[model samples]
Target: MSLHPFSQRPRYSQWFTAKPQTVVVQPTTWCNLDCTYCYLPFRRLKHEMSAEVSDALAESVAAFADGAHPIDIVWHGGEPLALGPRKFTALLTPFEELRRVGRVHHYVQTNATLITEAWCELLTRHEFRVGVSIDGPAALNSQRVDLRGRPAFDRIVRGIDRLRVHDIPFSVIAVVGTDGIDHPEELLDFMAGLGCRSVGFNMEEAEGINTDRQQPTPEQAETFWRRTLEWSRCHAGELEVRELEYLGEYLRMIRAGQRVDWDRRRLDPIPTVSWNGDVVLLSPELADTTDVGYGNFLAGSVLDRPLTDILGGAHRLRYVQEFLAGLEGCRAGCEFFDFCRGAQAANRYFENGSLATTETNYCRVTRQALVTALSTVAAKEKEETV
Candidate 1:
């Protein structure tokens, strides 16, 4: 995995984190419900991971798992639970020994429509952290529908209720598009009432197959974050918003005059393994996307090569090289570089059509807008104190 002399510069030497903190595994791609804004390319297809794939993944995980830092094995997909409890449990069996030694932790990002008492028992017994994808109340969640185009909200809530009954704590991931952004207070109230551990907002973007997305304007984005921050402050400590939490930490670091160590600020590889065992490094959103230049975004297959070896050679990929160059551009240009480090690879590719570029509507709305909102609020608060 050698690079040109220019790429061998000190700054580019450690561009990517060799040991990733998280690995997303696609157990299956058979999603029951059809969400309107899904970006997955093969969501309609049914593909289950073979036992050999899991065994190979376990071997890769074992090689990376040191006792000090526990790697998060996130089971993500077209809907991981679509595989059902029994089959899913078999998949979990491979990592059981690694988990017992506290070298790995399991997490599942699911739609929650398939959750049952059996699923709850499996999740609890395995201590798997659950993340549910629900936009808002029934109206806002209308986009999540069954194959018959019927709203799946009732079923989703039913599944969540089962989780509650079993005392399983879970976080909520709400997709906020033009519809839900304006009603921040209402959205906050709805999420807080769910008794979720935390809330994360995912702004809709034109990614993968979901092109022609209607994105919010810059003003609307800023206002939405401003209002959301205001609402969060009013109900302080009642709900933990992921963006606001990160904002707070960033502000504190800035105030303390802490500069980013560019060398140490390497991007996490975040290897996303497809059901067939193909590994896509960096963003999980890059798993199935393809380009003429980058091919199918695959670094290598875990079944054929060790995960560590695949990651080691990741920097040599054409897209990864371009992404590194883009990061350098971002570091040199954007004022928000310290906050975001560098914006996401998927956003740059999907929205801007190239990974070798910087600035996109996705980053402007999600990253810059939040920073502007919080900085304004903090400055005004400081004035009042004086």
Candidate 2:
């Protein structure tokens, strides 16, 4: 008999190797703010995760890490800070243990309203990367107020100052409403003055209970972004302005000779598991049934199904495919598609009805803005050269 049937197979097999990166976890669906364009409207209440659910989530995260994949756990709304220091510690203990064995890295995305000294201590102790949501200054942040209609700018600035005082590393996330569109330079300058090492700009998306469609037009958006990018190129200092919408265009302009190996759609994946054992398909926008594309795409409860199976299931793949197709559609037809990642899932759904079929307002704004700005830059450069 042959030593063994097909026994001499190669030692290395693609199937046996591991794929890095995993899920982004949402610890709760609750939030402190009632921003006009929030995607998680239903998350206004205080919903805490039971120890049982936390334990199950920890196990699931570890399973992914055990497979040679480095797991990343992103703590998000409503406001994870609402969990309080003691409860939050309880929630993170299991993951912290896993981190010692090189299983996971933790990150927190917060509004900075509830950030306290204790919270900062926990974050620094765990070396968690913090991303705080603050629009621009008082004027720009007015729309990001709490349910009581009080502006959160002062509170947010205080939280930021606390972080800086304690030497905790953090980044800022600003939402560009119509007002900010007209004053992009002022907004950019405001954030730059905050001493943030990195800043992310988000265009307002109409979602949740507040259905006000008050975003800048495509032409206006284009102008705003172009101005912001020009400012960045000249006076960014040590700060890195991370404009997700214009990342592709910047990369193309600066690294034209190099092949860009990035997929903006894949920045955050679907089946985002929540604290209440629910799994949402896309961002918080698609989580509420009132939102345009809201459907019961909840794969399985964290307490019920294996995370690996849920992540690999047909439903999850379909959701991602839908988003990828939308992105491709923009890439093929739109002039500024390269700069904006089509549009966000929520924006597409609320504005269009389907994430896959929608033409994003952000896309319109980005393309128009980028092309106009680049043309202006080229003209200026030509004049200088002459």
Give the top-scoring candidate (lDDT).
Answer: 1
Q: lDDT value for candidate 1? A: 0.87
Task: Write down the TM-score of every candidate.
Answer: 0.95, 0.83
Cα RMSD for candidates in order: 2.0, 6.9
Cα lDDT of model 1 by residue, 273-367, tens digit: 99999999879999877776786889999989999888777766877888888888898999988788885999999888888899988889889
Return the TM-score for candidate 2, rounded to 2 decimals. 0.83
Which sections of candidate 1 miss by over 4 Å?
1-13, 260-263, 379-386
Report how far off residue 1 is in candidate 2 (Å): 52
lDDT of 2 by residue, 326-368 (tens): 6667768866555555657666656775656646665566455
Steric clash pairs (candidate 1): none
Q: Estimate every model's Cα lDDT from 0 to 1.
A: 0.87, 0.68
Model 2: CA > 4 A from native:
1-22, 66-69, 244-257, 260-268, 290-295, 315-332, 335-343
* Model 1 error, position 184 (Å): 0.7
Candidate 1's displacement at residue 25, Å, is: 0.3
